[model samples]
Target chain A: MNLFKLAWKNITHNPLSLLLNMVLLTLGIGLISFILSVNTQLKDKFEKNLADIDLVIGAKGSPLQLILSSMYHIDAPTGNISIDEAKPFLREGHPLIKRSVPLSMGDSYKGYRIVGTDHSILELYDAKASEGRLWSNLLEVTIGSVVASNLDLGLGAKFQSSHGFNDDEDLEHEHGTFVVVGILEPTGSVIDQLILCNTESVWEVHDHHEEAESAEEEDHSHDDHEEHDHEHEHDHAGHEHSEYEHDNHDHRNDMSRSQLLEHGEKEITSILVQYTSKTNFQALSMPRNINENTDLQAASPAYEINRLYDMMGTGTRALQLIAVLIAIVSAISIFVSLLNSLKQRKYELSLMRVLGGKARTLLSLILLEGIIMSLLGFVLGILASQLSMAAMAGSLADRYNYEFSSWQWHGSEWYLLAASVGIGFQAAVLPALMAYNTDIHENLSDA
Target chain B: MLKTSEIRHSYKGTQRFTFPEIKCDESSSLMILGKSGVGKTTLLHILGGMFKPLSGDVSINGTSIYTLRGNNLDTFRGQNIGIVFQKPHFVQSLTAEENLMLAQKMAGNSVSTNTVHELLQQLNLDHKAKALSYKMSQGEQQRLSIARAIINKPGLILADEPTSALDDENCKKVVELLEDQSEQLKAALVIVTHDNRLKQYFKNHIELS
Candidate 1:
């Protein structure tokens, strides 16, 4: 009874062809939407976790890996740098430096990282304790909201940490068990997956480990040293301990073990630095100075992540280009189908003319068919993209502790809608014109 | 009333036709008989407003239909002229009733489903109202074609060899159906055909020599 109703009938008249056109269009649109959603979320997570850190001074290694391990908590650390080597950046009232938080990351509980740092990290994440209170002792620990929920840990729960960043519970440091004192609120950042403790607990656990290993070494070498040489062996062990202490000192005399534990641990993994101001000159010059002039390596999170983006952008751009190409090809397929159907419908169009149907009426009918087809395809495509995103949500949560929601409407989708409608309109042009200019007499007479 | 004055038409690189002028009153039927190449269909097209004669005018009722241009001409044609094309071509996707409704719609007239259903009932096709046109039998399709033509209640009815492909019995039935519908609606009926079998159906006949 109506043009649109007529168009719907015509499109449904050949269901297989309609399905073919819709599938091609859906695949193209679904791929593009998937890429857009992931790309937007990834960029958002990176920018958020970067969180105003200007430089990361860690042991000499790949700057990208250092940023990944410190800022993203996804990669292995670049060995360890002594606190003495990293002290200049963390000193009180140091020029060109606003604040720095040193990290000691050689442990994980379950699969979640157990980060050793100061309270400044809590301030960096704007963290609040939802249960109990922040860690106040050497062995007390505070778990992030995600870590607490994922591991099902609660207040007063005690768990040992593995020796390194690996998830193996067999390598757990049995000498010390960290007691959970607090659980943080959900921050929606990497902090939500961390178990935060002070650096002293990490040093103490490793120190006990080193003592156990040294005691076993003495048991093995007792026959070679004899009873009189035991005193000499004590002198040698004291010398070795002093040498280990000197690794963290710069010729300062009369240093205590507590001072060593506080400001000069034999090793701290990395330091997160913030400049005094955005316009500070050292932001540009300091990373270069440290990488070339000091034993430590400095990395700017922004620069390394941009490099990551550029590398990722190439693959994404290629995929996006392929998606666009598929869309264009589907448009052509629509055009071909329209043209083919027009040929078969010529006499029918002429019959409409005989029934007083205008040329423009026929033109509009064909165009309306194309528009209807495109609208159906667009709706299906959006649903397909959402389904794919939902399928990917679980793994993304497991791997990056990132949540992916499929319910958001992207602004880019408007452009996609326009593109689809435009393609439909464009594809209908020739067939509509052919229908418009049909010779009623010849067609009716021929039939 | 229907009238044509000095109508003529031609195909590019083919034959030309100069048609004889004719006139018919309401409730009357006229048959245009011709041989295979006499351009009977072309003359029908001209009278139905499907084509503009190279040099002539066709007036249905008091208005010169050829003088109306674009959609105005289409609207006039839809309101005043009904055409039954040979072979009963239709929008295959639509049902018989819907086709009639479409004719009324395209003519810019308000579609009345009651009127369509009533006409199909009177034409003995009410049982097949929802059947697709291509799925109908030959006799049923021809009747559906007649229903579509008379759905708008036009002042003139034009048929282009509506009975050419039928047998003697169906051909006579189709001719009677056209005449009866035209008389009932008080419209001038015109049939263009090369078939001699319809020569006895109408007394008002024009021979296209």
Candidate 2:
């Protein structure tokens, strides 16, 4: 009876053509929506984790890799930098640096990185303990919110750190058992996926591991020497070996925290430096100066992330172009289907005029049909995008340890809605005009 | 009540049509008979207010239909006149009942499902009310067409070759239905056709060309 009802009826009259048009439209809109959401979340996460840190100084390698490893925690470190060599930057009261948090990483638990860092790292991300308290002792650990939930590790939970980032039982360190002391509130940054402990814990775990290997080697060498030595010489070597074992035991058990850090060639993965004055000349020149003059490399996270985006933009642009092309094709399909239906329904349209319906009524009916189809397609496309994103969220989090919210609405989707309706209007104009200009006398006379 | 005066029309690159004057009072019926090419359809269109005459007036229910233009004329026609065409055209997607409701809605009348049901019952099409219009048999479609034409309760009903595609039994049945409905509404009825079998049925007749 109403124009909307009439329009709906007309479109539903040919179910196959309607379904085809709707499917094509849904695909186009869904792809565009999916891409937009992913792009937004990626940019959001990168910017949030960029934080107040001005530069990352690490062992020389790809500047982008240094930033990814140090700032985003999604890549392996370039290598470790000796703490003695990095001492000037890591100094507590250096004039150019407001704060420096040194990272010593080469350990993980169940694929989540265990970052051995100072408490300053929490202050850098504005993080606070949501449960218990921050790590103060050599073996006590504070977990990020995501780390705590993912590993189901609450306060007082103890687990041995794996030697590397992967979850390998053989590589699990036997020398150190880390007890979870605190869980940090979600900061919406890379910090949310890290486990923080004092830097000495990493050194202690690896130092014990190396000492064990060295003792095994010394015992093997003594056996070989015994096969070639006189009894008196072998007895003399046995006395020296026990003396060396006694010293090694003392070295392992008696070293204090300060002695451990200041001992021969201590190393850390990276130094995350925040400037006292961000816009000053020293802050601006620091990365280039370090890259050119020192053995270390300093990467600006902002600069490197921009380059990353530029690299990703090309693929995104290509996908957007393809989605647009699909949208155009869908519009054409709408036009073709409407025009074909108009041809078959010419007599019916003319008959409406004979039934005392206005010419504009017929015109609007056609327009309404197109608009209705496009709106339905748009709704379904949005739902499809959200559902697919939700389905992919688990794997994406497993890979990047970043949360991808499936149902976030973006402003651009409004523009997409308008564009969809515009496409529908454009497609229906010709058919609607044809309906408006129907010749009642000619059409009715023929029958 | 319907009347026309000196109605005429012409299409581009076609012959001009000069139509005879017509008048029919309330509850009366008139048959305008002519072969094809004589503009039998043209005269029906003018009387139905679908065609503007070259220079004439068509008045239904004492209002000059042609004098009203554009939407006013459309509204006037919808309120005062109902039309049934041969071959039983419909909004094919709608059911038989919905098509009847559409006529009432388009005519700017309140849609009364009761009236639609009663008309379908009178036309012997009540059983097919929910059936898609195009799915019905030819005779049933024709009866449904009559149901749509009178759903708005117009002052005048115009039939253009209404019985041309029907058989002898169906043709007689359709004309009688039209007559009976027109009498019930007390509306004037006008039938334009080339069929000679209708000659014995009409009380008043005009031949064109």
Candidate 3:
């Protein structure tokens, strides 16, 4: 007997129009919600992995590509730079530099990059071993949390490295087999998808291939050399044999830090630099100085990422505008349906007035119907968006090696709820006023 | 008792009407007869408290209804007077019984299922309690309309051409039902119609040319 029950009955009395309005509303709201969720997650991932690196110095190439390759590990490296040319920035305790971590890439295990770096990388990303211990030897390795779970690699698991960032059996490096010694905890950063080891391992694997190729050349031209050349070849083969035997006995016997640094001819892919004071004049001038005076290219990660966001913002803005337009269209649909029903219910409204019902009662009854329809559409729209996001999460993670969660609440959704209710109220106002002003004598007359 | 005095009305200051004074005592019936365009429906609207006369007063049970104004007038009219339209109309979404409950509720009275069931049984509509009001036969809809009007046990009942659309047999049956229900509540009854067939049923009559 209450207005709410009566409104509900009136809505249910005409099923086709109600269903039409609900479908349009659900589509419009769902699209808006889905876009908001994806935009939030993309911004979150990009900001989290920025990691406060002041500059990236690499071989001359695109500055954005340098940041993407060295920082996010999503693109190909520009090229390798000789360590001798990069030594001035890599030196310890330089006045202008706070810290620098050198990176040597060009290796992978099952599409997960094997990054060769120093212990400073672990501190840079605030990474800690969740199981076992961090790698302290040349051939040992530490795996990211995602790599461990996805490839099911645990402590003491052994795997050989491939020459590039793709899984190809032909490019497998048979001379090197890395043993996982630790698994890092998830940091929700780029580090969670990498396999980290010291710089010497990458050098050792490639150096062994070079020496083996030269030895085969010497065998084909044995007659051209003198007796001393034969002895020199035997001595080098014996030295390599002893090193191989020592690898199995004790991993700590591998090349020490000083010995690896003494080899000045080595090459590394990039160096990630942090400034002693970011606001200092020298730090601000450092990237430009390196780019102009030297052969190396220096790029600021924050600037590059901002450029990337600006490029992406246009597409998202267009999509958001389209979603809002659809929502407006849905409001118009609700208005038209309610207006039509009001026409059909003219006699019924007059009957209510004659039966001692106030004009305001009829007004509230129409308002209640509109609000109920909008609220139902709002709830269903949100559910549909979240469900679709969760369904797409698996493939997104596999493609980008980043996790996306749909359960997190966003503040914009509350605003969306308010907007939906406002639309409902706006649509109902005209029809409700019409019902309030119904002509009782004209409608109820026997003419 | 129901009474009116100096009842006069006009539409947009053009056509005008001056109705004769009317008075009906408890348990009595009065019929106002006129052809179309003679303001029979206008007089019914004024008597039912839906239209305010240009200059007139309608009093039911010693309370002047038109002078009450706004919601007070609406509440008074709902509690003291019942109206039956010429063409039977209802809130189409509600069932026959729910329509009765709604009338009682709108009149500031608690819904009494007992009274609703009793009225439905008396009007031979007990089997249609759950049926949608608009889906019923024309005769059944007419009976349901009467049930809604008197659900609050008003002191005055007004009918506007209540039987003009019915066959001779159904018209006779409807007139008997209205008289029987009005006598049971001991309310003053007024019927306005162009159908001369009802002239023989009421001794008290007024005609407008």
Candidate 4:
């Protein structure tokens, strides 16, 4: 009997048409909601991953991709800068710089990425293991929750890595098997998708593979390397071939351990640094200025991830505009249907007029119907958006190294709610006026 | 309270009918009996402020109805007149109570649920309050239409061929409902019909030749 009831009944006067209208609007709202939800998730995950590092220092290239591949488990490293060249920044006793966490990726264990870093990187990032402690030796590995779950990996488990993003890449490494020592919890951070281990571990297995290759070569023609002369010392079987003999061939004879590290002889992948204090940022001017200003490109992960989000701005806004445009179109449809009903409703209009309705009262009733339907539609739309976000979280998180939870309503979501209701009322006004201005006697007689 | 002065009108692209001047007030029932196409509808349209004549005017009390237009005309028409069309129209979407409630809203007056209940009781339609217009029998719908017409207590009741489609039993029931409702509202009643069977129900009769 109220204006809203009347308007709603009228909007749905033709049941199929009203359902068609709701379905169209629901889809429009659903698309915008999905984008908005993903945008929120992407921005949030990037910000969360950046929590471990104050900055990334590396070879000059795309800073965002560098962060994506190195800090997060997406993309490929932009090629390693020599540790000898990077040694000044990693100076163990530097007055201003704290310890750096080096990361080497591009190896995978059955599709899950393996990240090589020191145990200090785990402590520095506050990465608490879900099961045991961080990797203590070369072959030992500590992996992320998603990696463990997906690979069905546990402590004491061992696996071999192939090269690059897919299995088609090189599996020719001489050293392959890595033992899992620890597993991290699902923090919903990039760490959840990573397999973290020590830097020397990358070189150790590959070093063994090189030794085995030389041993097998000696068994054959053996002319490729002349110094690798193995006498028939087969008395101890697996222990008889000197492991130290092949290690000596590729390593430096003149350089000491510190000098070997300084000259890039002991290779590591990428380094993540945290400034001990704000003042320390100013003190590390040479490396910072060099990375940003010189041939090498070091980036603050926060800045570049935000830049990537900014790049996605146009696509998100366009989707939102399309959603609102369709909602407005739906509102217009409501108006058209109501006005059409007015002509055939003359006798009913005259009867209403005769019964006691004022012009303004009739107008209010007509307008109220549109508002009611829009409000209902708005409620339905928001529900659709929430569910869409949950569905996208898994695939996007796995592939893009990001996740979207419930969208925070204070930002763009508020605008969506307003646009729907405003469109509803805007559609109602014209039809209401038409109903109000109808000629009573002409209509009654015609009826 | 309802009266018409000397009024003249002609239809566009036609010249077949002329209407005689007639006035009916409260305390009387005016039945204008005639064959089809004698301008009874045109005269009804002029009296309800639905049309402006080529000459003369309609008045309520002493105020000219022709003075109102647009929503003002709508408001004046709703507050002063009750109309029952020949077909007894009702919005298909609304229930009987809702149709009556709409009439009350249109006159800018508050009619209580009790008022609607009591009016429905008088028309013997109280039991059918929740029925959709089309769901009710034709006789029931005609009664519900009458219930809707008087919800706002307009000063005049205009029913055009109210019983035209009914059988003898139902037509008598419809005329009785109309007569009883006009007396209850103190509305001057006017019924335009070609059927002479309705002459016995009205005190004042205007025949158009």
Candidate 5:
């Protein structure tokens, strides 16, 4: 009997057309909502991972690639920088630098990179071991929370790393095994997917791989050099060669393992640097000087990530524009449908007028129809976006180790709802006016 | 009670119509008869307060209905005038019973579902009350329209060509229903039509030229 009930009934009267209109609007709003949530999550995770670190000094290569690889762990390392060449920045008492954590990465277990880094890097992520303790010896490792669960490597679990970032069993470094000494708390950053160990672990595995390759060469009759004589003793017996023989061979070798571990021309993948104070001019000048004069590349995570965003912004903006265009088209569709319904209901409206219903009463009934359609579309659109986000959550987490939840509200959603309702109002206004100005006498007498 | 005097109307490019004065009292029925071009519908509209006459006055229940303007005029019309058009019309989406309730609501009258149900039963349309307004048979729709017209207990009931589309039996039944409902509400009834079949049914009637 009420206008609202009447309006609802009218909408349902032509169920197919109203449903089509609602679906059009739902798609428009759903697309924008989906993009808003995903984009916000990406920016949030990027910003969180970029926290506090002033500079990344890595091997000379593309500065963006270096930042992406060394800091964000999403790309390959530029190259290795010799420790001798990076000594000035690594020194504890360096005036401009507050701390530096050295990282050497060339190995991975099941696609999760094992990062050979100083224990200080754990502090950078505010990470603490959830079980056992941090790595204290070469090849002893602490796994990130996500890594531990994904690989199911608990405390005291042992696994050997492969030669590079791929999961190739052929390149396994069977000569050395990394034991899980600790599992870190979830930091929700790149740290959550890393295996933390000391820089010496990287050198130990690669060095042993080198000697094993050399022994294979000797086995193929490539050389009979004096050094090849010691290769037979520990050829591939799971690194169980005699300790006395290892010591004797170490003395006879060009450079012993212990000597190489203690500063004999070793290389590290990158160094994460922090300044004494953010406002200090050295923070800016030091990176500039290093990029200009040295064999290393020093990049700021903030600058590189912002540049990435600019490159990404064009695609996002275009999509948002398309979403807006869809909404406008939906508004036009709503306008046409309402006008048509008004035309079809002209006789009924004239009857109402004859029965002493005011012009405004008929107008309100039509207007209520428009508002109901838009509000229904809005609710359906929001639910669709959330369901889609829930579906994507698993894949995003699996691939990037980043979690995305659709339940989180985006700031733009309220504005989107308002715009949708406004479009509904705009669409209905002309039709409502038509109903309001209905020539009751003419229509009734004509009928 | 309802009365009209000096009512005249003209549409653009159409002949002007000056209607004859008429008066009818409570609990009575009157029919205004005319052929196609005599402006019987126009006079009905003026009497119902849906259209303002070129120069005329219409009063129902001793209050000048046309003196009210805009919303107040609409309120007065809604409260005092009940109209049934030649073609039965209802908000298509509403059921038969809801159409009556809507009439009461639009007239700013308190709606009682019990009254609506009882009216439908009395009109022999209780079986059709829950049916979609457009889905009912022609006779059922006509009765429902009559039910809606009397739902607000208006002082005057106007019917425009109500029996024009009916057969002899339906036409006679419709005239009796209109008179019976108006009598129950004590409202003066006026039927405007071009049909001669209704002449034998109403004693107090006028023919428009």
Candidate 6:
């Protein structure tokens, strides 16, 4: 503790130099902590939620996007296929296809990416809502923690989709509105950045899209009268269309048994399938075979994640190596400073030596000085890192759909602290040797 | 009381000293006089345990003090023996008070303001307590050095060229301070110098050849 006070006094005594050194040190440590924490948080999230699902079977164009979207909820999914096209496998139901969960992406509200998936997304992943129950009707949405916090949304809150990918475009989704029925807990994964609704909501939104646009135009012209703005023009456009089919939805729940045969491509973005286990390779192979032979393509999730890691893994490791090098350089700086002070403090050293101070005592004092400085530098590093994390929270959540926890010491924080202190103490070796020898007679003769 | 039995020391390739038996009894003063390079300073340093003689035995109060080596020797030197050098170097960062305090702390002295103040006033350095040694005049700095030497009230007081840089008046005052401290503390005083001015103050003197 006295060593810390002395180092602190020395640093504070030269405020300008101290400030310059601190700024450089903070930047170096700040960048390292940010990069390491982000990587760690991502590794943690992937290792947590993506455990059960071995491979993602989807209509894959870019296998990485397919995995990132269906598995991590980040990308825009590839187009959807027919349940008739989907029905063969649903009926085949190989043991490998433990359960197939269909996902209809491409629907969004405001800037929130909405995944039009069935309740199986929650069931397969073993996630539960903290606020309200799952979506029952079409046009209903379930928000995640980040979504709720960022958009100020909650259960029973209404929202309208923007035109593009998670952007608040001037034009809203032509469908009426989506009422938030549930809010998921903070999973600290990509899912927390999304807005989830039923697949039917996606279907219904497209169904009334053209009519909603036409009706909106009519209202704009009719708004000159200022009488019909409160008439719920949006609700009526989408409500009438659903009402026409409401009577027959129960019968049409299963597409193979549908009474009315629809025309054009049955609109769907993609289907995400999970297997019971890798041992059920026979069942999992059936879907891949079906997709390969049929219209859709089933890509493996493990392969995609591994490939993504391969693509980014090199650069990340390189950056981490650079951080380690910078830290080593900092340790060397400590060594140099301590070594310099030893020469200037010769008289002081001899004085203490003459006062019954052991050589080991002086050595510990120098070593303690280095450890204290490194620990202090590390503290400043962590603080700077957290501030950077906060600044990047929103954009990171939106882009990669990754969430960062508020800065605090975790299980491994102590390991980092210990490593820094060890580096500091070891760096003191050069100076420690000087103090250990101290040349008692040289200083004494001069004295 | 102090005694050196046949001490021998050499420097460079040629300089040598072979001292005969020497002694300083309790409550007495002894002066060793010689020209430059005649081992006057070397003998003083060896007695204070600053350097090891090539061959010799030194005893203080009948104890073989040479057995306590290195830093142990240093502690014994600070507490039991006080040395006044031809040139005294002070830590530039410390003030007059701090300078005295450092020596006092090393000697385990009580750090009494009265003792420090009296010493400062006797040396006419009371106004410079807060002033750094570098800021003081040479006479005042020499006086502070004397103050530092006696701060511990050591058993053996050794002074070398203590008056070399002083005016006659200041030299008399410095010698008076030394004489007063030696008697008050009942210490063995040994002065080594080429200066003849201090001959009048001491009763026992050795003219080194």
Candidate 3 on A1-447: residue-level lDDT in tens? 888999999898999998988888888898899889988988888788778899999999999999999998888999988777888888887798988889999888888989988778877899999998887676789999999999999999999998878878887888889999999999989899999987767766655655554566777774545544645644554455446446634756434434445546667899999998999998999999999999999999999999888878888789888888888988998899989989889988887877778989988988888888888888888888899889888777665566789866788889889888888888899999999998887777743
Score each candidate by Cα lDDT: 0.84, 0.85, 0.86, 0.71, 0.83, 0.70
Q: Point out where model 5 deviates above 4 Å.
A: A148-154, A157-177, A205-261, A279-282
How well is each residue in B27-53 modelled by candidate 1, as lDDT tens digits? 999999998888887888888888887
Clashing pairs in 1: none
lDDT of 5 at A161: 90
Docking class of 1: medium
Q: Note the clash tally of each candidate.
A: 0, 0, 0, 15, 0, 5
Docking class of 5: medium
Model 2 reaches an interface RMSD of 1.2
Ranking of candidates on DockQ, top first: 5, 2, 1, 3, 4, 6
Per-residue lDDT tens digits of candidate 2, residues A1-447? 789989999899899999999999999999999999889988988889988788999999999999998898888899988877787788667888998888989888888898888778988899999999988666778999999998999999999988777789988888879999999999888898999987767766766655555566667776555443434333443344345435545554322333334532557899999899988997799888888988999998888899999999999999999999999999999999999999889998877776678999999999998899899889988999999998888778877676889988889889889989988999999999999998877777776
**Model 2 lDDT per residue over B105-169, tens place:** 88778889999999889888899999998899999998888888888888899998999989999
Candidate with better DockQ, 3 vs 5: 5
Q: For candidate 1, lDDT tens digit of each residue in A293-327?
A: 99999999999999999999999999999999988
Listed for every candidate in order, the interface RMSD values in angstroms are 1.1, 1.2, 1.2, 2.7, 1.1, 4.7
Error of 1 at B131 (Å): 2.2
Q: lDDT per residue, candidate 6, A146-262, as tens digits?
A: 789877987789877765465756667655688998898876556677787766576677546645655676767854433344235435534654763475465433222132113
Cα deviation of B199, candidate 4, in Å: 3.5
For candidate 3, the docking band is medium
- What are the per-model DockQ values? 0.70, 0.73, 0.65, 0.47, 0.76, 0.28
Residue-level lDDT tens digits of model 6 in B1-209: 89989798877659888987889987799988889878876788688776678889898877667888655766677788877777766645567877777676655555577778888887789999989787898888888887888778788888889998888998998898888888888999999989999889888998888
